[model samples]
Target: MRADPKGVLTGDHYLDGDQACAEGALAAGCRFFAGYPITPSTEIAERFAERIPEAAGVFVQMEDELASMAAVLGAAWGGKKAMTVTSGPGFSLMMENIGLGVMMEVPCVVANVQRGGPSTGLPTLPGQADMMQARWGSHGDYEIIALSPNSPQECFDLVIEAFNLSEQYRVPVMFMMDECVGHLTEKVSIPRPESIEIVDRKWYRGRKENYLPYAVNGDLVPAMVKAGDGYRFHATGLTHDERGYPSTTWQTQEKCVHRLVNKIRQNAENIIKVEKDNVDDADVLVVSYGISSRVAVPAIQQARQQGIRVGHLRLITVWPFPEKMIRELAGRVKAFVMPEINYGQMVFEVERCAAGKAETYLVPHGGGWVHDPKNILQVIEAAAA
Candidate 1:
């Protein structure tokens, strides 16, 4: 249950992962949800469909993921906090429009509850297979926020953060959850409204006279105006100027694209987040995220009990990769090991951050089963030896 700032009862009820995701969005002031049905991820849409009417919001089941994602962008432009949830297959369909969201600077959330894939390998099974895709699925050079949750509670929390980042950066933030977290039943404590920090999209409040949609002012993010609020602005897939008008000039095109890119690229330091445990005097730093992080805790503890100086660093924000922290840890630790479902996704980021200062290794496994920490112990032994 959550209370308004006034401490009124919003509602208090126990919910599974899917239900909790919907409640999280509602609490975060998301008024629109558009998605297609896909297992594990489907319950999120179902919950939203049932709750939105009560929340005085809109819920739409689009014909496909592409349209569903498109509708989310449209809804956000119409001044609604919007989101869509889908699994691997539907997420593939949503990629083109995901690029559109990036190009348009629209604020929206796309939750990818990942199942095994390379074309529907497993519809109802777990996989951390979407980590790399989140960074590269959409075409073009652009930065995006992607958060991975290890547990149902973090799923709810990260969804809220996803909405905040989407609005703050004017980009589509992705909540990347594996089928394990999406289907797992767990007790998640919904905080009071006062406990939540909600960031609404920066809206144009000053005189709308001569408002440039892509204006490069002192603030990197410009205040956005609602589409139907009598603010006439043109949105395009083409290279455009600050006035949101198409530009034929090369210089103008470069300037527009550069600002859009730097607005996020430069803010990498402020956006990246990771959770560290007993790392100060550690010989090995275990790098993991999402559901794999759950396995890492015990691995670190068992290693510690054996007198190995091992620690864990769990990435909460998978994108905007935590380069600085990883770099700092590389100087301190003997080796950095990545345990993920994928063969080698974030392991690349770790190596980049390590820059040969520390040895990096991959303990990867996939196709429905999670990477066990016991395998990680062997890597620790090798590094220690």
Candidate 2:
């Protein structure tokens, strides 16, 4: 099988989610990766390290997750599509740099192959507990795009989407993969480079002297410039003006932070995605993402056989929480049954969107493994009742 000039394999092959994710990044033109080895996510870094040389890309095993995240941001400014991968404790360690990435409007990707966690929980197992952390872990009021992939095939497909979204929005997109999907082997079809669409960062093209680092056009996202490219620009995590200088005042903060939040919030409809099945006439809707979505399939089928009108809503983009769809469905459905590996993270979002219009049931699992189909079925049965 012939790969493209950049060394992306262009054929169908069996792969695990981690390896597929690595290929997806390469196909999407990710030329730099900086990451620390962490459980369930190390394979992604390993695969990228092994294959990146063929693409003339760079891979660095950093001292820790914080340095890994920092290096990713630095690489992005150096005119490279960059990413980093980690899980649980490592994810927590990278929070500060993640906030810096947001404040500086850096375009990059962070993949968290989630394992069971409060601290150093289950290293080799699956968990969906990081859903909320993906949104709020950075310690500020900013917006982010997050994608969850349920299978190895999706792991290949969605990482490309994650990189595209990051470039388009100038935000670090979070790829939330649970350990179950990360380790699951399946057939992944890698399309040719010509067929796959890649979104490069909107680089500033006008006169170098006239460039303002944070100046935006019609879209709230500003155009970028490569570092040391004969362009003088300052980018800081502090509240700054369009020139990217520190101007610590409430006014500057409002203008700086507001656009950061609004850029994604206002365009959420264009950015958010979900998979809906049989929702038009269903009495109960099964809301899930990641491995839980795959596990919920059997329970959904069982409910259908038992004559319950149950539909499934699988979250493809978890953050910017698909509020409008949930609110619309809540008006019609009797209740929403959410089965996530976490105790009750995304279920809260469902409940908030439902807004007391319908009941919300949580089939909570404390991680380590996926939910039992029987447990999910019982919740669906009760929600239908």
Candidate 3:
């Protein structure tokens, strides 16, 4: 699908990750952005507020995070590509409605520019602590698509991918970025509108009288209709049947929620993206994502200089967690070392997926900053030993 030319900022420019992200959303055909102002991530909303008008869309400064999340979900069902941006505290407030979006199968993007802490930690600082929260914060059994961008260029590039995936899967896709990446500056080139491919929302083309909001027609993803498309459809946070009315019976519950989980699970391989280097004969692998992956490069290079056969695997998609790839590598490598700004959030995932085939080590940081390459280097050396 071609992007609307008016919204696509097609050219090369030096931009920060947050600004690049906003351009990405615009190019991806996002017509509505609803968010509350918050540090590190506030730039994303500011940019959207300034730019979305060109596309004949709206940017709303919601009363709070809860309202922002709800508004995004509402806009989505109204047939607009919608999104919201926030930091940790706001991310927490957005959780309930995130589940609502999931239950209603609303297609939207939630970009959480991660900062330090469980509460109001260092708002201006970077942290990868929210990696786990992005997956399991919302209540109930469901699955989500999440992407992590390691640089400003990718920040611009991946937001388009995030929106495309959300439309394809009919779920709230998380664009997880750390404070470092959010604020970091780099050159970004947005392609021409016709050059950018998009996955437009799957609108129901069947008879209006037979519209079923939650019915999966063979592909495990239901077609959608706008609120005023002359189709009466129901949607809610409650467990729902194909008609989207609340359903509490075991059969309805099993059928509805199970499809939600399986749609992403069955398509896991296609959704997962990773970058690997030097694994053919490496004895140890260094795993990281988001900003940490950039910070980890020096450490891996140093390990190679020191005659250690170390490889690197940078996760571009954090959810679905790439269990199959990690599991495969575990059988060949001696150990896996993960360095993140959190104490050990993603390391737990690595350990679980490794499943005893290889030793897993976590080089934990308590946030506020990126990992020192030397710290990761020492761990890599030890893992090689």
- Winning model by lDDT: 2
Q: Give candidate 1's error at residue 18 in angstroms.
A: 2.1
lDDT per residue (tens digit) for residues 232-297 in model 1: 788887777777888868897677667777887789888888898888888998888888899877
| lDDT agreement of model 3 with the native | 0.92
Clashing residue pairs, backbone N/CA/C < 3 A, model 2: none
Give the alpha carbon lDDT tens digit for every residue of 1-385 in model 3: 7888988998998999999999999999899999999999999999889988888999999899999999999999899999999999999999999999988889999999999988999999999888888998998999988999999999988999999999999989999999999999999999999999999999899898888888776889999999977899888888889888988889999998899999899999999999999988889999989999999999999899999999999999998789999999999999999999988988898999999999999999999999899999999988888
Q: List where candidate 2 sits over 4 angstroms from the true fold.
A: 1-4
Higher-TM-score candidate of 2 and 3: 3
Steric clash pairs (candidate 3): none
Report the lDDT tens digits of candidate 2 across residue range 1-385. 1224585788999999999999999998899999999999999999999999999999999999999999999999999999999999999999999999999999999999999989999999989999999999989789888999999999988999999999999999999999999999999998888788888779999999899999987799999999989999999999999999999999999999999999999999999989999888899999999999999999999999999999999999998899999999999999999998888999999999999999999999999988889999998988787
Predict model 1's lDDT versus the native.
0.84
Which pairs clash inside model 1? Answer: none
Off by over 4 Å in 1: 1-13
On a 0 to 100 scale, what is the lDDT of residue 338 in model 2?
95
Clashing residue pair totals per candidate (backbone < 3 A): 0, 0, 0
Q: What's the lDDT for all of these models?
A: 0.84, 0.93, 0.92
TM-score of each: 0.95, 0.98, 0.99
